[model samples]
Target: MKENLKRLFEYRELLFNLTRKEVKVKYKNSFLGFIWSLVTPLMMLVVFYVAFGVIFKLRAMDMKYYAFYLMAGILPWNFLSQTLTQGVASVVMNSDLVKKVYFPREVLPLSYLGSASFHFLLQEAMLIVFLLAFRVPLTPWIFMLPVLMLLEAVFIAGLTLLLSTLNVFFRDVQHFTEILLMAWFWMTPIVYPISQIRDNLPAWAAKLYMLNPMTHIVLMWQRITYNSPVNGPASYSMSPAGVIGTVACSLGLLIVGYVTFTRLEGRFAEFI
Candidate 1:
């Protein structure tokens, strides 16, 4: 593992270059280019706000700046979704390079993650701009954005490495990931508040829901970006135990994923 870490470090430049390529290639021929990144979350915000905030009346429940709340969760969720969707197929998509190259195989998924992270940051900035435009108060907790992003990234990188490695062997893993993410999105408290789960579900069921790692991560995003005092105590759902568990889960997954990726990477060429 130490040797793998040293070797991956040695190829850091390669990772950066590949990440750059992924970002550029993403919008290579598009007329809107990077604007689409901002546009996508904006569109989601509008649709969800109309559906939940307007139609469902979630905002009537004292959820101030509900659009901001939606964006807070949606942006990070999109980051994870895009990373998995693209990263799963990354190794197979670059079979020629994989067969010819001697560099770290992990770079492929990490590069896609880098590209998604770029868009995630841009969307988050756009969200902040919207907040300022609407005269919403900013809090000291907003400074913790980078820390939250890093935690989410660690969780994503682990999943990407593990899934991408397996994807090379089983093409179905890529397709399965898409379906899984679709279900996973609704399972996390993105479109709705976490309070709904606690209030609506039985205690045991709510406890099971909290077991989702993304649940804590998304709630933390909502807590940092959306949970103003005016939004009430219900909006503030993150607990110390949840934070500790999330950090432990993220680190554990990264280690397990890295070990799995490295062990199977030797057989990747054969499978691909």
Candidate 2:
């Protein structure tokens, strides 16, 4: 791992260039340019707020500003989904670079992550603006956001490495990833609360549902935004044991994903 880190550092310039390229190409030839990053999330937030808040009244019924509440969760979900969608194809998409250049293939996904992260932060700025506009009080729990975001990034990075490497051999992995993410987006409480699952699902099934690391991650985000701002006591539906289990699960996936990537990467050039 030390050697790999050292090599990546040696190629840091390439990493930056790739990340810049990814960010630029994303908005290139578009009239709106980077503004779309903020607009996309805002558009979705409006649609969701209208659909769930106005039409169905499905959000935290107690909260007055459902748009802000929905934006908070949606921004993070956008980051994760974007990272995975691009990361899954990072290797195959950049096959020319992989073949011509001699750098760590892992950097492709990392660079994509860097670009997505840039966009994530931009979207978050809009979320903060919404908070201020809605007069949502900022609480000390907002400090915990960095921790949750870090864990979520680590989780995505591991998956990126694992999926990018696998897609090189089995091209179907890329297509399958889209379906998986679609299902995952709904599975995670992006638009709705986790309580709905507990109320509707059997005890065993609810327990299984909470087993998803994203469940805790999303709940933590909702807790920080919804509960903390109102000075409502911090609460997570997942037990302490469940939280620990999810953290352990994320760490394990990181380790296993890295190991798997390194093992499979030897043949990436041949397959690509």
Candidate 3:
């Protein structure tokens, strides 16, 4: 593992170049180019705002600056979705390079993660701009944004490395990942507040829901970015235990995923 880390460090430039290429190639022929990143989130915000905020009256439940709240969760969710969707196929998509190259195989998925993270940062910047435009007062919790982003990135990196490696052997893993993410999105407290789960579900069921790592991550995003005093208290659903468990789980997953990826990497060329 130490040698693998050293090797990956040696190929850091390759990772950066691949990440840059992934970002550029995504919008190569598009007229709007990077604007689409901002647009996509904006569209989701509008639709969700209308549906939940307007129609369902979630905003009426003391959730001021509800649009900001929605964006806070949606941006991170989109980041995870895009990373997994592309990362799962990263190895197979680059079969030619995989067969010809001798560099770290982990770079492929990490590059996709890098690209998604780049777009996620842009979307977060746009969200901050919207917040300022609307005269919403920023809180000290906003300073925690970088720490939160790093935590979320670690969680994503572990999952991407594990899934992308397995996907080379089983093509169905890629398709199932899409379906799983669709369900996983709803399972996490993204479109709705976590209060609904606690209030509606039985105690055992709610405890089960809290087991998902993204639940804590998304709630942390809301706690920082959507810190409306009214809705804010409810967002603090995670306890100290939950936060500690999440951090431990993320680090452990990264180790397990990297080990799995390295052990299985030898068979990747044969399967591909």
Candidate 4:
């Protein structure tokens, strides 16, 4: 682990190169370039806001519409989606680098994901501007944002390593992971609140929901976004148990992924 960290520190140049390359490739030929990130989430929020907030009049406590509710969900969801999608194909996509490079294999995927994570932060900065426009108060809990982002980075890095390594063994990893992400997205409380589903589903359903780490993280985000009482229900809320579970799961995945990738990395060039 120390050696891997040292190698990443030594190869910082390649890391920056990968991140810049990804940003360039993603925005290449696009008129708006990076603005496309804002467009995607904003359009999504509008559609859901109208459908659930306007058409259905579905409201969650004090959150009258989906826009406020969704920025919380969308931000975290986007990070997970982009990380998994890009990570799955990282090794296969960088077959050239994998075959020729002497550095850590995880760095490539980490760089791609690091770029995505930066974009997520950029999206959050945009969200904060919207929050101020709506007059959302600046509360003490807002300090938790950096802690959450660090936790999020660890989670993404772990998953990215797992999928990138797997893709070499199974070329279909990308296709299947997308389907998994879609199923996982719906499993999360994106379009509606947990209370909305609670009455409709059984206790078992709620337990199943906790299996999704994003469920806890997104809800916590919503609570912070609203500047409501921490770990308490007041127009917004979160289950401390749930968020703890998410962190535990994330760490477990990171350890598993790191071990698995290093174990299998030496064969990547031969397979790819």
Candidate 5:
């Protein structure tokens, strides 16, 4: 395990090239180019806002009950969701290269994540712009963003490792992933705020939501942005304990995914 980790560091160039390739391919032959990333999320936000915010008039008590609420949650969710969907096909997409060359198989998945997250970063910048446009106050607590982002990277990479490897064997994994992702989006506290659910809700019910993990990530985001000037009193900011848990969970999933991938990778070339 230590050797594999060391090897990853040793071949950092390979990582860079692969990440660059993914990013280039992402915008390849596109008319609007990278604008697609920004457009997609923004368009979705408008649709959702009109449906849930206007028609239904959901009173999002904690999250300002507005478009910004969905923006914060959706931007991160879009990154995580899109990366996994596209990354599941990473190994197969490079099937020719995989057969001919020998590189850290894990690096392939990591590259997809790195490239996708680049777009995610752009979306985040736009999110910041929205916050500013609305006069949301900024605070030192916003510095916590990088830490949360790293946590997000860790979690997404882990999931990709597991999904991409399995995807090679079972083409149906792609279909299954689609269904799972749809369910996951709903499970996450993206479309709505967690606080609106009432503090006195049954413990089991809360557990059901928390089990999603993205729940914690979303709440942390709301806390960070809301603390500024957007939606004050939206949350209790992540404490040391919360930070530890986020990192631990991210690392734990990453390790598990690596083990599963290495174990299953031997079969990828054959089964795939």
Candidate 6:
């Protein structure tokens, strides 16, 4: 791990350049450019509002301001999902660099993380604007937003490292990741509240559901963004145990991912 850090430090400029390229390349040749980032979440917000609020009748249920609730949850969820979707292919997508370049391979995924994070910040800015427009009061809990986001970044970094390395060897890992993410997204409480999961599922099932790291992360986000009463789904509240679970799960993934990535990276060129 020290070696990886040292190498990354040495190639810090390359990492920055790559991250910048990732962001720019994404919007290249588009008149809207970065505006699409703002438009995308809005589009999803409408789709979710209709699907969950109108079609499913969540609007009459516990959720009051369904748009606010959905937007708050969707922003971070997009960051997590987009990072993994792009990061998983980072190694193979840049096979030429992997086979020929001498820089740390980990930077590839990290750069993707950085790019996704940048877009996430933009989406977050939009969310804040909507919150203000809706007249939602911000509170002290808002301070916890950065802490939760940091934990999420650590969690995603770990996954990216592990998956990108694996993809070099098993090309199918990329396709498999798409299916896994689809299941993972629904398993998370992005569209609905955790309360629904607890009320509907068996006790044992709910217990297992809480084990998902994203569960805690999403709850924490809601705790920060939607903690104030605004006639929305009951504001999510996380206990001390939930905090510990999130920290432990994130760190565990990081440790395992870093170990697996470094161990397998040596054979990356051969496979790619």
Error of 2 at 170 (Å): 0.8
Q: lDDT for model 5, please.
A: 0.78
- TM-scores, all models, native as reference: 0.96, 0.92, 0.97, 0.91, 0.90, 0.95
Candidates 2 and 4 compared: the better one by TM-score is: 2
User: Against the correct fold, how does model 6 do in TM-score?
Assistant: 0.95
Provide the lowest-lDDT 10-residue window in model 5. 228-237
Cα lDDT computed for each candidate against the true fold: 0.88, 0.79, 0.89, 0.79, 0.78, 0.85
Consecutive 10-residue window with the lowest summed lDDT within model 1: 228-237
Task: Give the range of the ten consecutive residues with the poorest summed lDDT in model 4.
Answer: 227-236
Among the numbered candidates, top TM-score falls to 3
Candidate 6 lDDT tens digits, 1-272:
78877877999999899999999999899999999989998999999999999999987775767888888788999999899999999999998999997777888998999999999988887887778888887656887777778899999999988888888878898999999989998998888877788789999999899888888888778777876343234433576787897898889988888889878888888888
- Candidate 5, residue 169: the lDDT equals 81
TM-score preference between candidates 3 and 5, better one: 3
Those runs of model 5 whose alpha carbons end farther than 4 Å from true positions after fitting are: 59-65, 199-201, 227-243
Candidate 2 ranges beyond 4 A from true positions: 228-233, 237-239
What clash pairs does model 6 have? Answer: none
Runs of candidate 4 with Cα error greater than 4 angstroms are: 60-62, 227-237
Candidate 2 C-alpha lDDT tens digits along 1-272: 77777887998998899889999999899999999988898888888888898889764556566676677678888888899999989889988977787788888898988899889877766666667787788656777877877777888888888888889988998999999988888888777766578678999988788777887777777766554333233445435875687678878877777777777776787788
**Number of clashing residue pairs in every model?**
0, 0, 0, 0, 1, 0
Name model 3 segments beyond 4 Å from true: 230-235
Sorting all predicted structures by TM-score, with the top scorer first, yields 3, 1, 6, 2, 4, 5
RMSD (Å) of each candidate, 1 decimal: 1.5, 2.2, 1.3, 2.5, 2.5, 1.9
How far out, in Å, is residue 58 in model 6? Answer: 0.3
